[model samples]
Target: MKLIIGGAFQGKKEYAKQQFSLQEDQMRDGKEADFEELFRVPCLYHFHEWIQKGLKLGWDFDGITERLLQENPELILISNELGYGVVPMEAFDRTYRETTGRICTKIAAESQMVIRVVCGMGMVIKNA
Candidate 1:
């Protein structure tokens, strides 16, 4: 599995496409995809949003991780870095940020490669 992360609109998706030679159909937009679709797609964008949805639906992180690992062990995940900005004023936003960070940490630990993309450039943070 490969994990790609950066700020919003930071070219994470483009970097994944170029690096992986992925076709348009191989990548799923998390904002629009259902959980089932997310599992089926090789690459998933907006991964943080999917986490938020899972939280809203009362799905625990362990369940989400287990399902994802079972379905797509070779997945490429793209998520924005949500913890760097000013702390959110709303409780939900704060929770979302924290949850995303924690989940990303777990994913990174398990991933074969982790890349941080900024301004269209990708820096490999981990390789296993």
Candidate 2:
């Protein structure tokens, strides 16, 4: 599995398409997908939104993580880096940011490759 992260609109999707030779149809928009449907796609974009949905639905992080890992599919995940700027004032926003960071860390640890996209360029952060 591969993980790609960056700020919003930083071309993470484009980078994944180029790097993985994936078509737009092959990439699932996490915002529109449920947990069960996520594994069906080769790439998952807007992962932050998926996390938000899971949180709203009261899903446990460990459950989601385990389910994802158990699938063991070659997937490219795209998430916006929400922890780089000023801390959020709202309680929910703060939780979302922290949760996203933790989840990304867990996924990255299991991923074979991790890349950060900035201004349409992909910088490899990890390869195993």
Candidate 3:
């Protein structure tokens, strides 16, 4: 799996497409995709939003990383970098940010490549 992260609207999806030669239709939007879709899609964008939705729905995500790596080793995930700015006052927002961060960290550690996009440029931070 590959992980692409950046600030909002930083072109992470586009970079993923160009880098991997992926078609736009092949990528799923996490906002609308069901949980099962994550294991089937070739690429997923807005991953943090999906986590937020799951949290709102009180969905259990235990062992998600293991499942993804096992079920979809070729998946590419694009998430906006969270927990970088001021902490949110809302309890849910804070939890969402922290959850996304922890999940992303776990994924990145196991990913074949981890890239950070800024101003439409991708910088590889990890290759394993």
Candidate 4:
């Protein structure tokens, strides 16, 4: 599976479509959650931790890995790259950035393709 990754607000999806037809496989951002409201953010950071929690509840991070063998997915994944910025002050802010960083790293490593979009340009970060 190809994992296209990039920084915040960069059009990662616009690039992911250059090679493969795009499909949204996101298990996130479809609904508003409580934890997100508590943090006053329904942002990537909150979703990062929330997703891991859901994964334990039977969501398939690994199943996507296995599905690659049976299906060729033009999976267009949009990830907010949070590692390249300044440190946050609030406790929640720090936690969110850290969690997102870890999640992105893990997924990027396993992807067949990786790309970094900067200034509306897409640069390939990985390939199978």
Candidate 1, residues 8-103: lDDT per residue as tens digits? 999999999999999889988887777677678899999999888877887656656667788888999999999996999989989999999998
TM-score of each: 0.93, 0.94, 0.98, 0.58
Candidate 3, superposed: residue stretches over 4 Å from native: none
Query: What count of clashes does model 1 give?
Result: 0
Q: Could you say which candidate leads in TM-score?
A: 3
Question: What lDDT is reached at residue 92 by model 3?
Answer: 91
Q: What are the lDDT scores of the predictions, listed in order?
A: 0.89, 0.87, 0.94, 0.51
Q: Which candidate gets the maximum lDDT versus the true structure?
A: 3
10 residues in a row with least lDDT, candidate 2: 64-73
Worst 10 residues of 4 by lDDT: 36-45
Model 3 scores a TM of 0.98
For model 4, residues 1-128, the per-residue Cα lDDT tens digits are 45555665666555554545433433234124433231232122234445445444544344433353244344334566666668888776676577657655665766666777776687887877
Residue 119, model 2, lDDT? 99
List candidate 1 stretches off by more than 4 Å.
Answer: none
Flag regions of model 4 displaced more than 4 Å: 23-75
Give the per-residue lDDT digits (tens) of candidate 2, residues 1-128. Answer: 78999999999999888888999889889898887776667899999999999889987677555667778458788999999879989999999999999999989988889999999999999999
Error of 2 at 100 (Å): 0.6
What would the per-residue lDDT of candidate 3 be over residues 1-128, giving only the tens digit for each residue?
99999999999988888889999899999999888899999999999999999999988888999999999999999999997879999999999999999999999989999999999999999998
